[model samples]
Target: MPTQAHINMPAEPVRQTGMLRPALTVFVGLSIVTGLLYPGVVTGIARTLFPHQAAGSLIVQNGRTIGSELIGQPFSDPKYFWGRLSATAPMPYYGAASVGSNLGPANPALTDAAKARIDALRAADPDNQAPVPVDLVTASGSGLDPQISPAAARYQAARVARVRGLPVERVESLIAANTEAPALGVLGEPGVNVLKLNLALDAAK
Candidate 1:
């Protein structure tokens, strides 16, 4: 038998095409164009088209900015129309911390919270026995909801009237004026924009 010697072949060196450099370039280009430029253009157009809304729909009083229509506010006094109960942490109407209570109907905590809100409402105006509006007792999906249900608005009418020393009928009229109907008559329930209504109240003075 002849002895055969095994010869090892040299391995080929892998080549680097430098494709990653171009891939990164494409990524940066697309990110700037699609993310930054597109958003800036759209926002500019929106502001130009809808000045009031694009500018935060803020309510101003006597040259001072009071609040925005996009956020709720706590109005515990009898003089003001109360907005929805807020689930914001640390304080009510905390826009920076907008969130719902996440309390299910079966949750005892939810029940107790709702009861507390109802008690407060009743204490503010004992004469009005109308059923409490759901919005009044429940925190909205967004803790910063800025509108109040029409029923809630009506619930607070008597208290507002008494505090402002105005006739109930007159206050009701104001509420009516501030009430916004469903969009195109089919989108959502009729609601009273609290910031606008409060601005109207200020203007009345």
Candidate 2:
């Protein structure tokens, strides 16, 4: 028999080429749906439905912007109700650097920082005999958290009232007015947003 010519089967088509087509189609479709359409629709709905919140919950005073009800600011004066300690880097209450102290329970640095805050709070309101609330001494996970525990608010009542020259009962009433009940009456704690209380306090002046 004559020798048969050696034949090589054509190389199998590249498997990657087959994968590329389906992958590219899926990627393009998903990008448009999720990255563009979904976000756009949600943002539009929020702006139309919750205009104040969608606009950063900004608090305006006398045609000037003061702060947002969603973020806290540092106030060291006895006349002003203090917010939570900010762990924001480079400076306290720097909204752009919202972050926590990231210190574990046993961290000495955290212990010292917290102790300092406790001492200051005690010093500021010497007559206040109630135990310091943890929220008053520790920085929140998000340094921008605007609200404080109702206990913390009450703790500062006497000092702010005295400095502002308002009656303690009046300041307490303002704090009550600024208090927001738990979401659905159970999801979160009853708290007072510092920005809102401060704005109302200013209006009271």
Candidate 3:
């Protein structure tokens, strides 16, 4: 009451309101555009342009899905060409379990596995005098490799031919035909798709 000091203090500037509204609006807009719109457009384009690959590159026979060209299947029969060793667990070539053996060169487990595979191959083809191809005994990095080096295919050609009662020349020719050239003519080494080659063998019968 003592003249409340007639001292007047300037009122604080009105605090800025609604500054967050624009920021929130921008965040929502970008989320919708990038997360939803961008992916939808790209997927649609892929579906339209590369239908087969977009659909998983499936291989169908007689109205039934046999397998995918992109994934490997286990073929232990002597009459079929075998693919690389798969490290997938519980089941060979199980897509859900795609992985490498993760064994190093010095790992005894790897050495033993290679020896066992070599023994098995030798047992299967008692007459195959050619040195076994490395791919035949080694598991690929992904463990789901559908293809094998052409040399690996040839290593088993004689055995497959003998078992199927087909001429070695014919089996070799099939292998040649199934061999895929390096991508863009230089990206990768020649490889043969085991599943395709096996199916071709069946078809030739």
RMSD of each: 3.5, 2.1, 3.2
Q: Find the candidate with the highest lDDT and give its number.
A: 3
CA shift at 57, candidate 2, in angstroms? 1.8
lDDT of 3 by residue, 1-205 (tens): 5555577765444323356668789999999999999999989999999988988999999999999999999988898988889999998898998899999999999999889989989999998778888998999989999999999998998899999999999999999999999989999898999999999999985
State, as a TM-score between 0 and 1, how close model 3 is to the true structure. 0.89
155-174 in candidate 2: lDDT tens per residue? Answer: 89998998789999999999
lDDT of 2 at 104: 95
Between candidates 1 and 3, the one scoring higher on lDDT is 3
Q: What's the lDDT for candidate 2?
A: 0.89
Q: What lDDT score is found at residue 19 in candidate 1?
A: 66
- Per-residue lDDT, model 1, residue 137, is 90
lDDT of 1 at 117: 91
The 10-residue segment of model 1 with minimum total lDDT is 9-18
lDDT of 1: 0.86
Q: Tens digit of lDDT per residue, candidate 1, span 1-205? A: 9899999865433223466668889999999999999999989998999989999888776799988877878888778888888899989889788889999999999999899999998998898888998888999987888899888888898888888888888888889998888989999999998867776776674
TM, every model: 0.87, 0.89, 0.89
Residue pairs of candidate 1 with colliding backbone atoms: none
